[model samples]
Target: MSSTAAFYLLSTLGGYLVTSFLLLKYPTLLHQRKKQRFLSKHISHRGGAGENLENTMAAFQHPPGLPVYGIFQARTMEWIAIPFSRGVISAVTIGTDMLELDCHITKDEQVVVSHDENLKRSTGINVNISDLKYCELPPYLGKLDVSFQKACQCEGKDNRIPLLKEVFEAFPNTPINIDIKVNNNLLIKKVSELVKQYRREHITVWGNASYEIVEKCYKENSEIPILFSLQRVLLILGLFFTGLLPFVPIREQFFEIPMPSIILKLKEPHTMSRSQKFLIWLSDILLMRKALFDHLTARGIQVYIWVLNEEQEYKRAFDLGATGVMTDYPTKLKDFLHNFSE
Candidate 1:
């Protein structure tokens, strides 16, 4: 075909592709409104639960099976696994049903789950956790100086880095949320497969989701609760071609707003503005993300804010009508829910 003819053919095909994508993705998002309302109505806002412990980035273990909120722990976390696991295992053992972790592949392609694309902060060693072979990798506990005997509480137990499969085997019925750290489609596919092998109840997944990875996920299994965050979608569009992100049929858009940090305080310079802060979510958004959050929530998709550690902010997240707030301390969330419901 002539160059002009080839160009025309490709352009026509691309238009058809974009149309098909919008119809699939947007409608699923719209339909989620009823589900969102149901979730909002019944889920708790406060519990009479006791005073809670401070948590780090690793595991936020609560007792299993209570549907409070998913505990978030980053794989790129700096705390050693033993001390980390002490917290993580404790986080889950209490009552939390879900955990979010960052998953990436090493240079050898073994999946080493962690959040940062760079590992310098977490490992304190000069390396990307994703770029090292399992053997070349140092004992992770060495960095934290936490002894395995104390962390695992076993005389002869090994403290090697836990595998993706091992987590599934060890914690039956444990719900997981995996955030893909790299742009590898094949790696996401393998992780998806492993999720299927051990998935007993439900799983949630998110990522920077290069088009290839999200596309592969939807084509293979549509039932897994995949989230297409509004902020992330707009981000990918800005970063890549507009023609790309629309191809995936996403049922939910996880609009995550992290609780305030020193970084936020530095920029905005306010304290009582937390309710304002929860709405100030999408700090990464250079655009009007709050307007987008209202639009999405109005349509019925859930908007979950993360790490609502303080009582005032937790109350504000609910008062402002958020779908859910993720917390390191589910006990506090339960108390908030019970009191709110009363």
Candidate 2:
């Protein structure tokens, strides 16, 4: 505890604090901004699930003269008969900046765009997607409940499951965010191959929150941008609180996270147990740090908050420096963005 030793210690601490503050405020001083090919502010969750059937071809575009049968025979025929020359309403037609969908592998090794691994919730079939062949897969329920927005139901003309390759062919130029629902290596490999075959490396982003799954995806194709895994997210938060985020290098280009406030509001607060409510509150406090978001944005990392269907939630996300908002109701979000100022 000599005077000279104490003086040097204090000087070092002061220098570290000053450097950390500067880096926090201006991240580009140390880290170069990453150049991303596609940036989206309005991302459609499950191809605008609230508006359509949730990841059906009909949700993405008007089905071209496809024959209709069963319950949709009368209703679907009217919409399906419309010529492609005439403008039709769909998720793509409505102008979503990006499509956020989940992927699961069929028994035949084909990649399908779906939100659930089990078919019961979406299709009312008691089977896992992995156990069925592409042809054996059941159709989605005609009237489906939206996951993010409770009690809300959506209907679409085409309820058949769509292959990932089909989506790529249909929307060649659109950006897609694929969430790998399982740890299946084959699923990851197939998705990567499709992205490569379509030459959509720049516009397509894929990954799961599992660290192991994210690592496999990166290994499969490092060219495609990956989303942050849960472990990495925790690590980043740690670095931010420790004032070391500026000194660290970030490889993932996209950070897709949920808005905690939205979660609290989605389920009735009175219905939640005290512990559940406290956890949500804790997440709100930890994850809604404006300084952390600003630093990440400065480093050219796009931050997207998820499943925010309301206008106020969208405003909060943007005000917190989020680059994008993923919503089940893309049309609602688009309108909000249109009328929103600043």
Candidate 3:
């Protein structure tokens, strides 16, 4: 090649590389603004443990004395209930702007409400909800564990599960956050159909930790918004530390995560090791930084941390700019918010 041509080619390649590096290094320069449809200040985890039932109508019948959002579990053709009663209606009646639920597909292609695919934890049965037909599913434990206490027993009147359609039929206006716990085409299709039938595209959100599932959910219904996958969350975290969050185009509209979950080793009397405590501390500093939360909120992404029922934790979550805090005790949250405001 001639010297002149070589010089021009080198300059063009160098310019392209420089531009790319700048964009990656300073993602805030390319921020694409979006309008957030929903903003929740309080989200109840498992419909809030009252009367000892996590997702039962008996529990939900007792409102939190104020307007607070709630999260429920969806299983295969069954709503969350106690042993032999109807509890699906409880979620809609709780008077929250948004209701979050976990969805799983049954062998019969039925989309139901449930948190765990395996029925062992919530229900005494050892079968997977997906493996069993609608009739084969068992009832929930009479006494379920509360979020705050390790082994507290509460009892509710309704124990029978309800169908997913039942919830839609009951609460047409309320927005719902569907957490796709199982990655299945049938489950996705069913959820999409329900959302469409209920005309709730603008109000519902698709939540899954898996990127693949998030993609499928979008493909199934592009109208509904989706939560960021774990990969994107981590990527955002990395970008936050590098100060590139302001320049990037953020597609995720919401972040739903635990404050700081430490899985203790399997043994009696589980406790966090020193390393675990350190990790939690590090996460608090990095993830809960006010600057990070402010940046995301400015970009219209909502931050929601879960399973926090204590007064101090609630204070911390909001102090860090959390749009919403999920709790297992609605009454406690209500009281806290009321007193905090006072």
Candidate 4:
């Protein structure tokens, strides 16, 4: 090959490598396991009794002994730090000890908080967020249509598509749990980088997918913990791993051993059929929390569940033993925890 031809080839390969490197470091995953190992110190030998960030020690709101702290899904109308911060404030004031938030990557590669994949579903814009620039992303957040009163009332305020750094600065010491609703597998490295940037080891990265992405996040960002989502786990076990659960994969010496920090979500009822129920009788007996409690806690792993409603359910989960429950109504969960003690 001629010298000019070789130069072009080298340049092309170099560009690809640079792009790949940038994506992996978004949340800024540093290999500082010693600094950010939140679980190792807190979780009981069985992965329970993890403490709270703001008010109580654990998610359980009532004092130290009563279990169950509320894990809430907060929305950011402005993409600014205040919106995310306010959610934590609200959760705290209303008796909540813990809170949850959703994360996604913008076209410019900034990590932003958003519950929906497309802006259209929540804001009526027919575009994937991955296609828009940071400035372009802010225009839609101008007027949120949510009727929930709390978020809707704050519609006219200035909230930008927040950079992860903003959130870190606002809730520096406060503990938070983040849900990775988007399937941008490439963002794992970026998430690690940004996480290391603020040195916010208190935050936990969550997903439903299996061992692969979770392990990547944990390995890269040694300080931050991870949580697994229901769909992600099912996909890993049924199709990818061929019925073998997390430990089996790890024991087999697969590099994809399950991340010890994160917990698995169980399949919901609607997803199950009668025929399948008999085959997986054990699953039919346990809802996501029950199953996660039985599976993870027993193995000394921490687990988290999703959107549980009702006061009775909260008491039952704590009674049965769960590392955490992701709730849409943190205010309600807080109220429930308060009354249980009174």
Candidate 5:
């Protein structure tokens, strides 16, 4: 090679080596370096389902260290018994730092708290929650299914649906996460009203599965932080792998994801066909990487994995730099957390 060409090639190679070394040794150097506003060591999914009834006031009354996430269901000009009900007032009585609830709008444009818009699964009534006035809603079934295990049931004395306003009024000081279960404009608007009325702009977060719904949430109230939807999660994953994450701007503060729910589904009896299992397993393995968690943490974004009921999974998630583990069993999680200090 000519002298000039050789010199150019060597210089390029040396630069590449130096850059690679720096990235490997000081991984956080490229991150945004913003201080984290919130830190969640443990979160209660569905208000600690395994500990009590999922989304019930009973469940919300668990240990206080972790954040509690519940669902909202509402109706107008009527009322009914929701076994899991007790209103946000009861949840606030439990005294948690944060809470997450699902939001759905009734036919009358009232905001209610509930995980599903339909009332059949929880109440065993073949009716939609929206169609019924708050008074006409049916009581929850004698027993409710626990999210963590199959064929499990939660039985408690309280069974009445509570209004969203009740929650905002009861818990003015707490940070609450509202997961929009449906794409209803009225629901979004009603939620925004409550947030503004209570002056909880900094403490409220909007979450939903669809990107469109997430957008509506922001449009309704731009002040609160939002959780990443599935599409956003995929986009973030792509950026991370391409080394473009640090350059990209992310407005959302939380990434609440199921640890491996797609694969976890396989554990359900007779649900997974052989071929489906293999595909799910492969996908699970690929996404279960510590680097992804570490990268997001370095950028000051909180990574929370959900519905983890087992102790082993809790350890794995934390070891991989997860900011928090959302579990159905808050008592069990508290025990696990206690084990660490003792």
Candidate 6:
């Protein structure tokens, strides 16, 4: 209540405001630019689920069940009788800069590429991925529904579940974003070992939204880049709003997040309660700040908005200074990016 105390308080508040504004406008002032090994502006969600069966070999490479002839088999009449399949396009061929997929641990400690822990939705089998060995895994349903796009189904010739190592061998050069769906130490260890074995430490990004999982992943292999966990993201939003973001040292390299508006659209306003809709709208307003995005980019962090399927959503993400847009429809996104002027 003293005049001197009030004066000091006002001075401190003014100084903090000025510092926050300057840092928001120019984040490089405090943080050194981080060196990124791989940059992607077009990320395929679930290996372009809308274009092919999600996370299947057909989604990422050649159709499964195709036989390779050995040098001796080349002389066999069976090689000549085999028919060649056409019109099967892979996600890499569709011009996706990065592939976004999830991982789960099989019963035999193998890492498989899948989004859900349960196989009912994708494979139509009521079993946990961890309960089955890699070979015991069932084939995917003839027609699986796309997660992001409701009521839309995608069918492909290759319905077999693929091992993570197989995907690495198939697409060694492509950058991949791996989401650890569960808090399994063995799964994390296996994925880390695979990354090291494949020498893809620079090109692979792996983490889970759970802080515990992310920490374990980093401890397993600190060289590989990590996506922000849910706790870190919440802390980041808090710091950004409190004008203390610049003072903080961000360790994560990628900020992969969902666009709130797109999420709201997916939830369908008619189906949401008034309070749910309002919270989503409020999150949209708070998280969509271009200044926050620009500051993160300036700090050498790539911001990727995920699961955006439509062209308009892609345009919105790019317009808001997103580093990339992850979508279920890679072909559609490729076309949009091709025709995009900016």
Considering lDDT, which of the candidate structures 3 and 4 is the better prediction for this target? Answer: 3
* Higher-ranked by TM-score: 4 or 5: 5
Task: Return the TM-score for each candidate structure.
Answer: 0.56, 0.90, 0.78, 0.54, 0.80, 0.91
Candidate 6, 1-342: lDDT as tens digits = 999999999999999999999988888888898898988999988887876788887777634343320111212312222323666545677678999889999999999999989999888889999999998999988788888886677777778889999999988999999999999999999999999999999999999889999999999999999999989998999999999999899999999888887767666568889888888889888887788898999988999998897777888888899988998877667767876754
lDDT of 2 at 301: 96
- Per-residue lDDT tens digits for candidate 1, residues 1-342, read 999999999999988777645643464542444342123221111111111111112233332332333323222322222112222334344445455556767777776555455655444667776667867764332222111012211111122444566555655565555666666766776677787777642545454445555555666565565566445556633532333433433355455444334135435355546665665565433332343444456555566665454456566666655667665445545455656677
- Predicted candidate 3 versus true structure: per-residue lDDT over 1-342, tens digit per residue: 999999999999887666645654443456654687767776666556643366544443442332222332221222233232333434434434455667787788777777778988778888898888877778787777664545555655456555677667766766667889978888899999988988888778886999999999988888899998888888988976665555667777888776763222222334657777778768766777777776777667788887676677888888888888777765456556655666
Candidate 3's C-alpha lDDT? 0.68
**Where in model 1 is the C-alpha error above 4 Å?**
1-93, 141-160, 209-213, 230-250, 257-263, 266-300, 329-335, 338-342
Candidate 1 has its poorest 10 consecutive residues by lDDT at 44-53
- Over the stretch 2-109, how does candidate 4's per-residue lDDT look in tens digits? 999999999988875664344223212322112323331111100111222211112222222222333432222111111221222323444433445456787778
lDDT of 5 by residue, 274-306 (tens): 887777777666566678777667667788877
* TM-score of candidate 1 relative to the true fold: 0.56
Off by over 4 Å in 6: 62-89
- What's the C-alpha lDDT at position 50 in model 3? 44
Which residues of candidate 4, in runs, are more than 4 Å off?
Answer: 1-90, 138-161, 183-186, 229-284, 288-295, 298-300
After superposition, candidate 5 runs with Cα above 4 Å error: 1-31, 62-97, 261-271
**Alpha-carbon shift of residue 221 in model 6 (angstroms):** 0.3
**Best-first order by lDDT:** 2, 6, 3, 5, 1, 4
User: How much does each candidate deviate from the true structure in C-alpha RMSD?
Assistant: 12.2, 6.2, 8.7, 17.0, 8.3, 8.2
Task: Tell me the whole-model lDDT of each prediction, alpha carbons only.
Answer: 0.48, 0.85, 0.68, 0.44, 0.68, 0.84
Residue-level error in angstroms, candidate 6, position 261: 1.7
